[model samples]
Target: MKAAFLIPLLAALWPAHAPAEGVAGDFDYYVLSLGWQPGWCRATGDRRDARDCNPGSGRDFVVHGLWPQHERGWPDHCATDERDPSRRDTQAMADLMAPGLALYQWRKHGRCSGLSAAGYYAALREAAEAVRIPAPFDDLPRDITLPPAVVEDAFIEANPGLTPDGITVTCKEGALAEVRICLTRDLEPRPCAPDARRDCSRSRVLMEKIR
Candidate 1:
């Protein structure tokens, strides 16, 4: 997953300064960032999460986190009413989320969702389940190059209720990085924030193979 590595890398690179406080339930929508695992590992380094990068895993997209977003910038570490997931809750979350990325999401985004720890995570799972991966990406195993708009169109065609405005295709150095989808708090497809749209300006983006 791109954000699976991106968030942690960004956190490491972020300045060691006090972050702004967040206001609970103050956002407009949610952004479910699904990372293209192989694309990230290739850019970051070979020494990546073995479970995800191993040649036989056969997983292309992985849940990075279900983040709460605003019309402009987003929120993080809202009110310190944070609660760690319990053992049982952790097990349930693992069913849909990456283990390492789970805690970061809770601390950074989940805490600001204005829902209980259990409720927030449940929403994370719900958001993930709501989207249907396009057939081309449903079970990717080899690297493929594609145009960002083409990928976005595939996703829109696969998901009946989704539209171009509902999704964005992110790229890194002309490589497909992630596909960010926007959804309402209740999990229905929604248009993404103008700023949250994909940042790639290239005609072709490389999607590294899962291996």
Candidate 2:
């Protein structure tokens, strides 16, 4: 009877197991994040070294990542049997994203997609190509301060099938940071999950000029 009581006390003192992260290939949709290059460079002070921030780089909105999302939460750094991307593979994506970012995305979000590194990058490219960048953002001759909603509206107006519910504009340090658009597994526009639909509430966010 004493041993039984001791066993119960020990069990009660043991820590509870943390919830497991989502498994590979088990997410609801995708979030294609496009980073505003100038804003990112300004906010993070990466202009001195980042190739994407270099003058004459001509980069405006670059593919940040294509992430697997749940209806409620998201997943990251999932375990996968697929091999990590090689330098050649990451370098091939330099036109769209920095090589380091390409490799990191493959490790974090891509691993959850249950695709090989090659297949994941291919899908990322396909998803990015499907979205149209509003022409106005192409050449911002001067810094502009506008409501975040205006940016979202521009994207919605440019992409026929995309609605406000399918896209969100995020800001960092009162500057436009990223434009995240939800897409189906097939890369079609879709409504974002409630948790993923949070937009930047800033009244007027700065948009740095293209470098």
Candidate 3:
């Protein structure tokens, strides 16, 4: 759905920094640090799912970054109508967002995002939607391979109590760096609790289930 506006502009740019005593890091997917999502933010113009009267839309995803800038806002003034940035708590805006921009920046018109040597923030919905298809990269159908056992056999032929987990992927020379999946169902974690998230379609039936 237009990638849903990069999920509320990256939940309003991670302004809440609370974790600095005994230092705990490594939460992965759902916030708590480890910023960035998804390689250059994806979405570079598509718009074809608007139906019903022929409106034709869906493809305006964005998540550009530069958190904690020097007070003036708009990442030190680029447009200034305030695209994103403003809660007022400065340490030079948390030391200018602490990093060298890589992940957050997926636009599709007037300009797009680039640069990601893969140094930081690159989860990218595990590849897309439900997650899976990793390992020597065999699923090469392209257009962004998102085949976790065909979405768990189309959700067990359309919900039959849904029981499908067990994924494991690992490709070498072909590609698909590495991927380990897990599942148990019962989830909804978006913006907040739904059991705090889990069923990634049972982690795409556990990566891609070869075992």
Candidate 3, residues 71-187, lDDT tens digits: the string is 111121122221322233212222323222221221111011121222112322222234322233323223344444553344334433333432222232222222323222121
lDDT of 1 by residue, 1-211 (tens): 6879999998777644323467987778899988887777777635654565666666777788888887766889888565777767766677666565787788788888888888888888888887788888867767788789988998899889888888998888878888999999888999987878866888898987666
Model 2 lDDT, residue 11, Cα: 73
lDDT at position 198, candidate 2: 49
- CA shift of 176, model 1, Å: 1.2
| Candidate structures ordered by lDDT, highest first | 2, 1, 3
Which stretches of model 2 miss by more than 4 angstroms? 1-20, 45-48
lDDT of 2 by residue, 28-99 (tens): 899999999898887674836766677876778989999999886787889999999999999999878879
Model 2 CA lDDT for position 169: 87
State TM-scores per candidate: 0.84, 0.88, 0.19
Clashing pairs in 3: 68-93, 135-171, 136-171, 167-206
Give the Å shift of residue 91 in candidate 1: 3.7
Better of 2 and 3 by lDDT: 2
- Model 1 stretches astray by more than 4 angstroms: 1-20
> Of models 1 and 3, which has the larger lDDT?
1
Q: Is candidate 1 or 2 superior in TM-score?
A: 2
